[model samples]
Target: MAKGGIKFKDSAAAYERLAADVAARRFAPVYLLMGEESYFIDALCDRLAATILDESQRAFGQITVYGRDTEAGQVINLCRQMPMSGDRQVVIVKEAQQMRGLDKLSLYTQQPSPTTVLVLCHKEKSADKRSAFYKGAAAHGAVLESVRPRDYEIAGWLAEHLRRQGLAADGKALSMLTDHLGTDLSKIANELRKLLVSLPEGTKRITDADIEANIGISKDFNNFELCKAVLARDMERSLRIAAHFARNPKDNPLLLTVMALFGQFRQLFLLNYLRWQSRHKGLPFPPDGELMRILRLNNPYALGELKQAAGEWPNRKVFAILGLLREYDAKSKGLNAGGMSDGELLRELLLKIFLL
Candidate 1:
């Protein structure tokens, strides 16, 4: 069958597939790329323009519009246009979530032009499958893919992506970039691009020292180092990093770091349980790669460490730890009497994690 739906683990794979499909001129009547991850969506759309449409056709037939600026009537008009010296014309509606006449466009979609390709890019969420537009698109054989990248996978991908750019970052540098950027690819790419432009040609190795020097983050004090300190159970380093965050809450917000730390611990606990029971029963913990894919966990020692740590805790302690994080989250947002600096609060939280 020529029509099918597939999801990739991350943006790189998504782009690779999109390029291949577009190269083969296997364009679908309707293509829906929806996700919080914008990099792949942008790249896929760009690929369609650069490769699928010839220069002369693009001048007259390829139309790129934004939801906030363009109306649905214009989109429908473009869709109805005859291709100029090309097999098909492309209509890309970005931020399609903001399009005013999406309901109107649905009527035209019932019998779309075979010589036209419509791509709707909605970054926040998917168009409701029950809606007329979604239904019409699918009934006419559309290609739909969701581009959500897991947090852990981002770190791993960053390293590989950097290598492709002829730049190399060690594990610590990659980890630091993830911590500093907070899992946003656009921002990360922007920052990395800035770094590369300023670097000498043929520069390959990027270290923690170079990052701190260039990015203005303290080498000894950052989210990655703090997370490592907590994971390693080095309370002193954790407290020191907390103190730094407390002093400069604007730079290293306490809420984000706390959330990241707790997320890591929660993943460890889950994997811990999975390892213990799955091994004894001789059954796959995740039954497949489902849990691994979802968690984005890759460390060799991760399962073993989690098993050891989980064995030391009772169920009540796990619940209590979660409760503590919830309380802190609320208090941090000014729900309670939250006067203390993030560093002091994080220090207390690190102590709690260590105790657990």
Candidate 2:
């Protein structure tokens, strides 16, 4: 468990520790949940709400209040109240970031009631580190910073989430979800839940077909497949995928496609530079772990393809393709593109990438 000023590699790790503590019925005097990601914070709050008190105990002990309706001084007074019929009282302040005089809570936090569990749900923002309230909470209780996962980390997190549900997904299916859904954890979890429910009781595995059937993500013509085709330099497949995307412009926006291509080519350029440095400058090629970290690639399977593509596309070609991708990205955004439809722009971009 980390103390103050913590940076988790992913949200799941932070959730795991909190879940374990809550499950064990071990809690601190105060919990300050603050960060950009609300999914984990919301999950922890939900779990705490449901688990900390039973139906009978909740009626007497659990008090849920909103920050806008209550003051920091009122919260302290409530915390001072004794549990009617339980050992401890749980006072949850939702959206505590909006509470006026939040800093004044430091007065009570400094000598908090050992019999009260104060949960402050400060979503999407951090408390002032120098404030008395923040320092007091850090010294007396736990401070969980719920940061969102980066784009690359989503696939691995989704895979692990599926495994916990007794469901399995392949790399392609995982990539399809990641690419289509992006980094919105709440939406991804909801969709996966729907997919899980759609499966028959005995069904254990989720495939690209399952995703397509359940979530409307195409198995063959999606952005994941398009990127794979481009990385392999398969002119025929790349053009075909681009044409499919052109036909379904709503699903495959030209800007997103161009951005994906730009990222792939950028990775290749970096890999080329690193390889050059290793060859002539006596620097060793980074180990697999280091390479993945440097490349910001969470999918090892995709990393393999990227490494192969780097070898196939020379540094000079990668540079040129990057420039072309940048131009197309701007054009797709309607910067200087005169009247080109998304389809025509996509087709033109594919031609340039294939030729390069």
User: For residues 1-356, could you state the per-residue lDDT of candidate 1 as single tens digits?
Assistant: 01133444534675666668888988878777666667777777777778767786788778889998988888888888888766788888999988887767787678788898888887776676678877787787454455555566677778778766767776667767777777678888888878777766777898888778777667788877786676666788888888888888888877778666667667766766667677787877673346655556544344444445556554466667777888787767766736876666777777886787
- Report the C-alpha lDDT of model 2 over 1-356, residue by residue, as the tens digit: 22354554545787878889999988889988888778888888888888888878998899999999999999999999988877999999999999999999999877889989999999877788899999999899887888777666787788787787777887888878888887789899889888888877898888899999999989998888998988887889988988888788888888777766777778888889999999999899998889888887766887898887787899889889888888988999898888999989888888887777
TM-score of 1: 0.76
List per-prediction Cα lDDT, in the order shown: 0.73, 0.85
RMSD of 2: 3.1
Clash-forming residue pairs, model 2: none
